[model samples]
Target: MIEAAFRVLKVLEESDTPISGEEISKQLDISRSAVWKHVQELRSYGYEIASSRAEGYDLIASPDRLLPYEIEKHLKTWHIGRYFDYHDSVPSTIGVAKELCRNKNPSELHGMVVIAEEQSGGVGRLGRAWYSPRGGIWTTIILRPAIPVDHVFMVTMAASIAVARTIRKFCGAGALIKWPNDIYIGNEKIAGVLQEISAEAETVNYCLLSIGIDANISEEQLPSGVKTPITTLFRACGAPVDRARFLAQLLREFETRYREIESGEYHTIAREWKSLSLTLDKRVKITTPRKSFEGEAIDIDEYGALIVRKDNGKVERVFSGDCTPA
Candidate 1:
């Protein structure tokens, strides 16, 4: 069903006029009833297929779901998203990616993306629960980076820039990256990134970069007692967004930034990140495992550490922490 259905879909997609069931069966080497069954299966997945005894079948419209076929149709990158795994619901995309890395070859899994429509056990930074209801983007990309382990944090930095730029281009929102790896629209949070790595002392085995976005989810879908101000693209744009297209743009942007890092262009990422900084020059609370303090986020270093100037006039570099703007 998987291979033949995709083959049938590809033929229909490439055709300008409606394709007859008999013609599709002859081209695909399957029975006419098989073609009809696959078309029904595709329609159940939200593909609008028009059927008539005279005109045969025509592709009317594709759904907004993040199906592999939908993403692959619009994706233009070489390796990023070249191999995709989509699920209607899962505990976590990060969890699924970790299992794939453990069982399969890490190198082969590079540039692969795992997506879930809903996550029941999604976890964000510091093991906090991430609310991943339907109508959002919950995905994790597997990478076998050639860069040093010290520079691995830059992957998240690259992802941050990608998401920010994609939102600006696709949704027309003036999105900015909050220090570390969070996307914000003005003062409200719209997206966040969580990165996990399996690394040795100096080499990285594989990296799982997870990204979550509240694309079409409404404010009412979010649970109460949330700590920070949050927002969705639907609210910001006054309508639902096409999630599949946005994801393809993000993967392309990320692949470009990732290539830069692999080629040792740290300054390029640093400069772009600073220009899009939402926390710079603002008073923020930085809480690390050791201590907490208030400071102004002046800048970020080449390796993506937040350079903070404390109230005591002392400067410190924080590699990882929870940054909250006051």
Candidate 2:
């Protein structure tokens, strides 16, 4: 019904004058009664539909809802958001992506996105809870990359670079990427990425790349016990940003980097990721599932693994772990 109303409104928008019920029915191949029902539904959703005896219906303005049409109007990416599924509220977009991947064909679902205005059960890295308020950007990208399983970490690195670059471009602040997936502005975390992949023994089938940004969320909205310093765009700039425009820019940047990953030009992305990384060249402590080690963060290798030189003059390459400044 919502789609039908939008179709009617779009027709009215393209027309030079108002459209009648009969004309709308003929154009949309629907019954006149159906058109009336849809028009009423549109009104209920806060669409100002100017109705007159002579002029059947006209759309004056739309509600402040984050509809897909509004998002597509501003979305400029080629592939990142070509197909979008949105919800006013959801438990988690990553969960939605997982459910979709189970029944739906992954190869047919290229560059699809799942977004939620508010997340009730968002999970972060290491199974940590993510406090996702209504004002933040919470979304996940679904991709089927034909890369080796060992190189899957590059996807997280690519997304981290994209988010950091986008924040720096818009906020004009010095944004840096902490090792693995955190984005920071002067020691306060502003964004993070979570990557989940399903694979066979040697090939990857699909990857869910989830990125959450503290766009307009307030400090008061945050939960207690968050020890790390955190900041939002509103707090840093003293105003709310246009969320739709920022999201569009972020998707565009991500699509560009994703293409680089697909083309096996990972070293190029690795170089840029290293440059924006705050962990490189710092004395750091890394904790894996087994043990912890402290060393000088020397560099990240071509495959996006962190290389650390220990005080004992031995070097270690860590593929996945929790890293912190020592």
Specify the highest-TM-score model's number: 1
Candidate no. 1 TM-score: 0.96
Winner by lDDT: 1
> At residue 156, what lDDT does model 1 achieve?
95
Native-vs-model 2 lDDT?
Answer: 0.86
lDDT per prediction? 0.92, 0.86
Candidate 2 residue-wise lDDT, 26-108, digit = tens: 99999999988988877776678798889878778776545666677778887788888888899999999999999898876
The clash count of every prediction, one per candidate, is 0, 0
Q: Model 1, stretches more than 4 Å misplaced? A: 15-17
TM-score of each: 0.96, 0.88
Please give the lDDT score for candidate 1.
0.92
